[model samples]
Target: MKENANSALKIVASFVFVFAIVGVLYVVYFNSNGQPSTDVPVGVKTFGSCSAMSSFIKTNAQKSYPSYWGSGVVRAFTGVTGAISASPSMAEGGKATDYSTTNIQVAGVDEADITKNDGKYIYTLSGDKVVIIDAYPAESAAVLSEIAFNSSTERVTEMFVNGDKLVLFGDKTDYNGPIMGAEISYRPYYYRTSSFVKIYDIVDRSNPILTRDVAIDGNYYSSRMIGDYVYVVLNSYVYEDIVMPNITAGGVETPVAGCADVQYFEDVVDSSYSLTTIMSINVNTEEMSEKVFLTGNTQTMYVSTDNIYLTSTQYYYEPMPLVGDFFPRSEEKTLIKRVGINGNTVEFKAEGSVPGWILNQFSMDEYNGNFRIATTSGHVSRSGGGSSNNVYVLNGSLDTIGTLEDLAPGEQIYSARFLGDRAYLVTFKKIDPLFAIDLSDPTNPNVLGKLKIPGYSSYLHPYDETHLIGIGKNAIEAEEGDFAWYQGVKLSLFDVSDVANPKEMSMVSIGERGTDSYALNDHKAFLFDKEKGLLVVPILLAEFDAEPQSDWDYGEYTFQGAYVYSVDLTSGFTYKGRITHVTDDSLLKSGYYYESPYSVKRSLYMDNTLYTISEKTVKANSLIDLSELANVSLPYEGSDYYYGYYGV
Candidate 1:
């Protein structure tokens, strides 16, 4: 994975000003009953009325976060579709019983992805529509049906297919009028953003029935599906007027949260406030439930089978008023709120504060009724700030029972994964240090061993109980600096059977600098079947005809497709074959490197057939030798193109 170098620069830039960028942006509201007369949960406070909620917003916006403003929005596409090639008669008669599922963190909990399969059929997004393809047997695959979305302002990010039901998660932005009473000469339009969930009955493959359409106020954060329930999280921006978000089901619209339904922690003093809303939907029955909380800013969220952990970054600024100028120093902390999950009943359980910021969802884990989190502290905004990493083990009540602090000074965490009784962490500055931490003792977590290597792994996956797979970038240390210049995508197999000594068993590098892969960032893009010794990664390969003159030199884009490898503990990664959706004519017309509409983004296997999917095509190949078997082209090819790392 590519390192984010701009973070250090942003911290340096913040020192020139007294008031830094406001972390909190919006308020999230959910439709619920009036506040209960009973006592609120511990560490939770409620407004209890509309007037009280409005008063809190006014006081915080004016006195505490006077410079708070809305943050920027991000927009991206998933996949599109084209047409099918082979006939239905060419397919084998029966459905495949052996198939692979999405790569998820926990066993029972499922994460939404762009592509999913049910052995016999494939479900994926194509432009603004959902395309269902009859994919099986490798010989014949055809487009079964396409469901086009009518809304232009909405984009479905991902979906989940359970049994005969298809649940789609989307984001919609509507022009909610203009901002009033602004100091500017012109009026700025305000767009109300919300997340929507649409559940469809796919009992009949050619035509899907829409059973539920739910629109919740706020921007979509992330979602998880477990068993019959789908949990969606959203973050809403709060305005001074205290415009509340509405929960619209079918057609009836209700205010998502009144003052009484809103809950907050009195201990967390954030510069601004955000209304974080979490909703649970029963996909089978179309029944929904929601809970809203006032948090610092919803950052990294980790959900297990029993609970959801939401984390937000909190900043403490110290003002230094000089005779003529002012400067402010700041420190960073993470506020974590744990919410219990039981069917549709979502309630706050505990709250904890840690000394740093988390990397992502993988930075935290839950096991044996305890929560473990890894974070990086120092060097956020302070001058001469040296970086350090730490891990905290919290019990059910969110109390820190064990801590291992200041493990790798001047280095930050690149990736982390928690297995059954051990935790693996990778930190990198000039070299990647893979640390094995013992977590069997919840009250005394400590590091057992460390392995220093030349590159870093941005993502880690447990191959089994004793082995692991790492996907990241290969780098070489710069001659004059305390850092390394990343070269290419690196895949490694690590043997961790020896809890006290971890070693890189085998490794391979692809392309050179400027090469990229979707699997490096999104774990869903990675396809691994340990039983079959198969691993597939969607990569955009870059290379050079001659040796580079400097360490900063990058390679040119040469190939774009999926790299198939047979990986194991003994032999490591062995190249099997490569699959590409780009045609030879298209590559030549665009100087040998064009972001083809058919750039493969994901891969899956059903029995012996491997399916490589992209925006415009889905091709099936033989799992043994990767020989082309069938080509299924989707109908709609929209104007938007995935430019890959080489942007448009």
Candidate 2:
């Protein structure tokens, strides 16, 4: 989901780079051009030497901020806390079998997720540990091994399982809690966060051996695994003093990106700046490659087999004389930088810009050598004024070739999915408008059809070439504002066989006003199999017996589990059964209350048994009938930080 403009922070950084007092600004000066420019720089320039890099940074650092900088205040360093395709694999080189893999955008490329499996075993990150489960037969499923970290200041975010190798990514921060003295001492380096990657030889599942451990100075952004190569992205903030990001591997530390390795565009600059680094490691050979780009903070990343696209939102002010030009209008644009990847080698490819801001990584795609993107141009205010959606096609060189503008005016794009030559977009204000776009012409793309509905979908998944599955919320149009009041969690099946007339074949709504599902926003939480005609989503059902006080009144949490369904073209969605990790004891003690640790967050199926995973337990059930077969308790305990308290 996109962050609201009013709440989003504006970042500006100026740092003394390398061995000098000279400062460099990663931001572009607003005054350099009187108006926004469509003439985005084509290629990136490399800082050939430290002196050249220092000079470039120094020149940009001295540039003035945007005209609308005063609209938001800058607060510094408050040390406050905080799919249809199953890859058939052989277990131990045995007979080839079928098991569900990560639902990824690109076919060959794999995305990191909380849980991963390889036919016989399941690997998941439970709190601060990586639990490996022997999950072949449902009746005998059990936890095999676990790797734990320091629960005080370390966290494992996600991981990938490839054959005998298991790659894990996480963060380690220095600041555990706030100082408790009568007089608090604040330092610039009070909070230091570094992202780390660990590779383990899981050939011995019972005793996984750590082969390599590497740490880099930055916060984890995103990661992808392709074949034997895994790519990790990190964003490191540049402070007032010169402090280059470093990489520590095998007990030796080195600069992740030296002055010579850093690249930037002279024509692009924004308020937010960071050292965006992309690191590729060969899982088999343990070889690593790194490249750094000086740009605005990385917002959304789209990785294909050949390239990785990083997008960052850039804002510029336009003088509106009619509104007293003194208050400049903030205009948003997305800066896109593409880096080509071949095995373990990653190289800077091209750079470009789009007129509007993208919703997420799903808003961008690459097909048949052309790059496609969907964006929202103007800001949508409370009055629903002057906001429109757009789609732009860029060639291999990152130059605009085709344009589709002013789509669904007065509304913003809520969900987008690109399949082959067609794109599906959902935009909303008071109701949802699902647009079916034809991109076969590339240059003259137009809307083939549009379907208006009551609510909007935050995520769209392809059921097939001619169908789609949407998971979001049901809603009612408000009497006053241009927005709608969202209610129960909703699932809709769309048939797009007729490009000129798309239709919602069937739909289902769950719970009451405050119901939600993790699949709504996170695609990884969604599971579907065409062969088995199965669909699973983690749902948090909220319902109340008392009438709602108002449209905004929320319902009480009544259920937390995975909703299983049998979906088909003829019958739409058939509610199979639900699986819950919450024990009967907890349910009786708290009534309808929610237990954070028992909330099911992910679900996966292995052959005949389905696995529903929570922080506290992994429950296995029969795929035919939702009967519990086995349950394994996990070693995760809620911490003070998780309960909203600081270190105590």
Candidate 3:
């Protein structure tokens, strides 16, 4: 449901890279004859090597800033004092029946999350540390070690596993907190931020040796891993006016002085002191490469094997730009920039714009060579009350080629999924109305069919090529009010076999009024193995005896754990019951107040064994009957770092 969701591009197929380094001002030195204009076209500039890229950044640090940064930028730095090994960087897979990896959205693409398992070990995020478990041999599963952060400012939140190497990404904060008191030269005060990136080699089960560490002056944005290369995005708010940024490599603090070749885009963004940086590093390489571009906060990102898309949203108040009006005519638009990447090399390929903001990563998908996006425009705001939705298709160059807009008025997009040539969208106001769209013709898209259901699905997954499963809330069509009160968790199976008449073949819901599941929010919590017809989701349920006698009707914790089910196109959904780590009645007595983020945040399998993970325990169950096999009590369960999963 939540992630730091996050490339390189070639300018042209045959263009050879030239390192325009020290004293080389590519922005001003070259004139627009046969070369690029002062306002370069939206494309990438390649550095022949990592050293060249660093030199370019160091050389052009002054140009990296917009006109606004010179006067009002803020700067502050922190030091990490923990011991780090200086072993030489060494580089870098395996099996089917591996119970599938992480239920990724796309086949070859890997998304960073809190937990990652390669069928042998379960690497999960616990507070500020990563706990590695020998999960394969279920009965003998044990905690190998805990990888902790270097300082109080370091928080290891997300990670991605590439073969024998584990790349952990986190943010580095200053203990001093936000800069306070009077501002110098009339500039405002803001908090300083940075990023913490570390890679480790875990060939030996018990001890994981840290191979390399890279820290930069920016907050981590998002990341994706492909093959042995990892691409991470970092965003920095240049509050302090500094000539160069404070960066670190290995254990020594370094300066981004000689090679800060920051570049700018032709399109102007109003905000100042914003730098968007993308870093690409190979697991086997000792050196890391980075490209810094200028922009505002990167709101949404979509990454594929070949391209990385960074999108930002801006609100435009029209008709009243020059004059003051009580109710201004305003609208929101999202700007999308595409970059092509190969290993550590990144290039800007194309750029485009859509009407409104996207819901999540699933809202945008590339089919064949065409980029497809879905956005919702207009809303019932103080400015106006009309609402509209759209589906836009863009070509390789990011030129809007076709559009299908003005769909399901008053209802914004609740969930969307694109499969091959078709897209399924669910929009809700009072009820969920699922729309089926055809994208066979890029220039002219059409809505083939639609169906209305009681509730909306926040997340959608393909059950098969012809069917889909939606996870969301259950609701009764508002009995007396215009809106529905969400209750429990709803699962709907949709059959899109007939493009013209898609239907919800069947559905099932669990829990009571206050019940909730992590699957409804994060896609990572939802696990599905088509080969085994198995579906698992971590759910937290609260229930009452019946309708409340008073306005404040409180419910007690009914169940907490993962739910197992069997999904089939022919028979619909068959329940396999629940799996919980709560062992005694004493824990159950605690009830409603019971809060544990690790209380089954995720579930994974190695062949036939199903492992249910909680902060305090790890329990394996038989895949056939849902019977408990062997349970292992984990350490650090008392650590306050553990919080409720649904809080975020």
Please report the candidate that would top lDDT against the real structure: 1
Worst 10 residues of 3 by lDDT: 76-85
Which candidate would rank higher by lDDT, 1 or 3?
1
Q: CA lDDT of 499 in candidate 3? A: 76
Candidate 1 to truth, TM: 0.88
TM-score of 2: 0.86
Which residues of candidate 3, in runs, are more than 4 Å off? Answer: 1-97, 176-190, 240-244, 256-260, 319-328, 380-385, 479-481, 548-555, 584-595, 637-648
What tens-digit string does per-residue lDDT give for candidate 3 at 1-648?
011111011111011111010111112111112122234443434334435543333343434322122233321111110000011122212221445466676666678887887777788876556888877667777788888765567888689877678888888876444345534343434456788788888888578888998888878988888888888888775454342345688678765422234444333333323456777878777457666655555667788888998776544433333244333454666678788878766767777787876777888898888889988886533233467788999998889999999988877888989888899999877789999999999999999999987889999899877899999987765455456667778999999999788899989987766777878878888888777778898877777777765423445667778999998887778999888876544443234222564468878887778888776667888889988777866664344322222221
- Per-model TM-score versus the true fold: 0.88, 0.86, 0.81
CA lDDT scores, all candidates in order: 0.75, 0.75, 0.67
Clashes per model (N, Cα, C within 3 A): 14, 3, 30
lDDT of 1 at 604: 89
Task: Name the weakest run of 10 consecutive residues (lDDT summed) in model 2.
Answer: 14-23
- Which residue segments of model 1 deviate by more than 4 Å? 1-39, 48-51, 61-65, 69-93, 184-189, 320-328, 380-385, 585-596, 640-648
Cα error, residue 17 of model 3, in Å, equals: 42
Give the alpha carbon lDDT tens digit for every residue of 281-329 in model 2: 8999877766665665577889999999887665554434433332246
Candidate 3, position 180, lDDT: 50
Cand. 3 TM to true fold = 0.81
Best by TM-score: 1
